[model samples]
Target: MVFRRLLGSMGVGGPQVDTVLAGGAVVPGGTLSGQVCLLGGESAERIEHIGLELLARVEAEHDDGESEGAVVFERFTVGGGFVLGPHEERAVPFSVPVPWETPVTELYGQPLGIVLGVRTELAVAGARDKGDLDPLVVRPLPVQEAVLEALGQLGCGFRSADLEYGHIGGTGQTLPFYQEIELTPAPQYAHAVSEFELTFIASPAGCQVVVEADRRGGLFSSGHDELSRVSLGHADAHTLDWNAEVDGWLRRLTDRPAHQPSLGHQAAPYACAPPVHHDPYGHGAHGHQDPYGHQGHHVDHGHHVGHGHHGHHDPYDRHDGHGSHGSYDSYDPYDKDDDHRSGPGVGTAIAAGAAGLAVGFVGGMVADEIVDEIGDFFDGDDD
Candidate 1:
């Protein structure tokens, strides 16, 4: 996406700035390289500086209520200090480093509904205008991909993904808001958990995969939430069985109770007794549930569906700060639906559990009926 501006802040015939992000999604902690093209308007002007700001349409909740706004989280001075002649043209190239904490906009090239962007700020002749809004598309880190693919293969279906306003208490979270990718439980886990929320904190060393399970109460009990963090080396992703590991992590987390809170760690609590030992789905025996108990079941391989196909009928919240939010275009590379699929399914195999039950992977398109219902829910709220 390219944003061109006639330096709106300046009078008529000012320089125009347009930023073009090289097409293709970048990985977290990867380099995003592109160019800023500037064209001189009616007269000569002094170019002070050309800057780029990384922004997110983040959700903020306060005492007043819940609202959303554009937050400038990072900035860079790409170029400046020059004179523009009448009708002059210049292209300033840039190679900006994406932050390690950048949110994953897509998985296996599918849109997850997270909005991020790059705004080019041009200062010419003492006037500044952040020209054009280019949509930012980010792919998952290798480890993050392995984990999500594993979950989908494990039978979990994608629910909805959103950016939360606050931090998860016990994380090395650098950003104020964290992205939560929520998933409906696979059949195997349904007895123990109602749903699961996954958050990944990636860094140079590795990523901390935090899984939160909404535990369903037993025969006479009420439900609660449980959280567990698993640290994995990025390289180890290629060598381990992520499905088994993830299943084990869920077992350990759901079977345990509360303990003395780690001094600096804050985690959600569940109804079970404190876990005496870690690693429930271990090298040890993997427990099997009876016919009456909730079992985790994953279905077959599914296709990626576009956001438009989700039947979005609700009106966007145009009043929530910039009117731009309502105009966001959902771009899912895997959603092209052209002649070919992308790169052999990311090289991961999904373990579709039990028969007769439907299965949807994390990045797979949700069933048409369920998607329509969700869209209707949002639409109803507007009325």
Candidate 2:
């Protein structure tokens, strides 16, 4: 989608900015190429800088309750330092790298109800305005797709997906938040687990698969959550029999004791293949840093906050000054009280077929409604 908006900070007859992302959905850790079209106002204007921000609709847990807001995950200064004459038009092309942990908004071309957008920020004469907001479409990487396909083959159906604000302790999670893909349990495991949530942290070397199972309670026991982690190389997507591999992982997870702290760095119990081990924090493979120098957890508070470089404070930005590191014990992925909840019979089913899981529409909203919601979100209207 192309979003066109006038630089309102410049008052009437100011320049207009339109950002258009290239066709096709982007994958995590891939490059996002787009063009920012600028139309000069009635008078000459000095453009100081043009910035592009990657924003996600994130949910956070607080002492009072849960709240959803827009989080600026990454930003890039694509163009700047130019003077546009009256009525002149210019197009600034940009090719920026997306963060490896960026959330997937779709699977097989179907919306997962995860909202992400690219907003264009224009600065002129000490005034800045985030004038345009366009919806962002991100598809799963090959490894991610293979994992999900395996779950489908095992009879696990997709429920819903969303971005949660917080860090997963003892993992190489770079982003301030992570994506949770909720799925119903396969028939074989239904007696043991009600559902499970999947999280993928992809880096240059490989991807980390984190699975959290909502296990059913016994006659005298209470239900609890169990989490497991495993590291896999990119090539494993094509080499491993994902159905058998994933089933083994789930069996081990459900059978583990509830009191055990996470299955940290453990290899999956796949007998066909030997244990695959890789460093979880191997960022040195590509020498990558947090894309945004700040832990940009600034909340929009149901409105559009100014895109300034400083003076913005977020109570939820719990990082240690550096954008990359943080430990949040408050954000629980298993909490069901959050406004967004997806359970069995609560969302559109991702039907299992001969090939695998077939793509379906979003759970709550259709395609057109999602577009409208995106417009409303950028317009500062939470309702």
Candidate 3:
């Protein structure tokens, strides 16, 4: 019996835990219900506490370059305070509310290459172990879906999506990080802009949409970024003609003069119009100061420019007078190709004049590879 206690102290025969999420994909601001199954080992163990943490793989930009790490955005304590007899089994069920700003991992049943997970930490007798981790699937909210669908209808192709570790100034951002969905410009606007980065901040009251464009340079002019934003209520998703609304926003975004300031900034050309919020840290939002006083606000745009150097040397290898763009040398299932090839070719088809975004295009080899890569990522992190 003494040997068994020593083994338990050493975590050789302690309680084991496994968490299983209740249902299919859940949306942001929705409940995540799951069961934490526990099985006792050779000896009885004192159950101290059980915690569930919501984690996201976020990219951080720093002086040395960029690095990816897991960020625990939320934590919940469900149940504990009991002793589990040897070889016994008990399941603790819990339902917790996810944050309103949780990044969406999928759209229309297709994976967007964003990784999120729920980690179960089991505490026993002063020792804690992360027993289980499950991949989380978050679908876009109605307003978010409508906007992306509208972009697809307008011939914009999905490029990639990632969670950037930083706060966007001038908005009611609750989370420390925000999601950026990259999209290729449609033929009509391709001549003026290279790409568009879309960000949505959702709240119970409404949603804020920020669109940043990589404006193309002329024969003598240098390229720069342009930003615009707008607000919409939940009902507007179904009420407004999204195609027209989104098209108008894009038209104004690309057509604005190079020297003119965008909306929300002081002395912006559209000062008289309803103000649209933007990231003060974003590049080329002329005249706007970083409210956070963050040192590396200029580096955000440079990160996008570094995407071209992917599959080669480290993008952040050289400072080159430009801010540190960082490197994505690690496994990126959604890595963008130089010729603009994307995962599953859904966006390519959409840009090729498909009626709308299709479902289930992520299949066969591409699907298997994505699943394998994501599985390896989470599994390796378990160590």
In order, the Cα lDDT scores of the candidates are: 0.59, 0.65, 0.62
Cα TM-score per model: 0.68, 0.74, 0.70
Q: Which segments of model 2 are wrong by more than 4 Å?
A: 1-3, 257-364, 381-383
- Between the candidate structures 1 and 2, which one is better when assessed by lDDT? 2
Flag clash pairs in model 3: none
What is the TM-score of candidate 2?
0.74
For residues 1-383, write the lDDT of model 3, one tens digit per residue: 11112223436766677787887887765567888888888888888888887778888776688888776676677789999899887889987665657898777566777878787777788977776767888877666777887898788887777888665554456566789888889998898899998898865555678788888877655567766767676556556687898888898877866543334322211111111132212111112222112222111211111121112221112222211112111112122242322223444333432222222233323435655655566655642
What tens digits encode model 1's per-residue C-alpha lDDT throughout 258-317? 332233433332111111222111011112212112112111111111111112211111
Error of 2 at 4 (Å): 2.7
Regions of model 1 farther than 4 Å from truth: 1-3, 63-65, 257-383
* Per-residue accuracy of model 2 over 1-383 as CA lDDT, tens digit each: 24365646788778888888899888776778889999888999999989877788888766688788877776668888999778788999987666668898876666778899888889988888888878888877666777887787677878778888766654556566789888989788888889988889876556778887787877656566666777776556556777787888898877655433233433212111111221122122234443212222121111111121212222122323222212211112223333332222222234332113223435356667777777687668221
Model 1 vs truth, CA RMSD: 15.4
Those runs of model 3 whose alpha carbons end farther than 4 Å from true positions after fitting are: 1-10, 260-375, 378-383
2 or 3, greater by lDDT: 2
The ten-residue window of minimal lDDT in model 3 covers 267-276
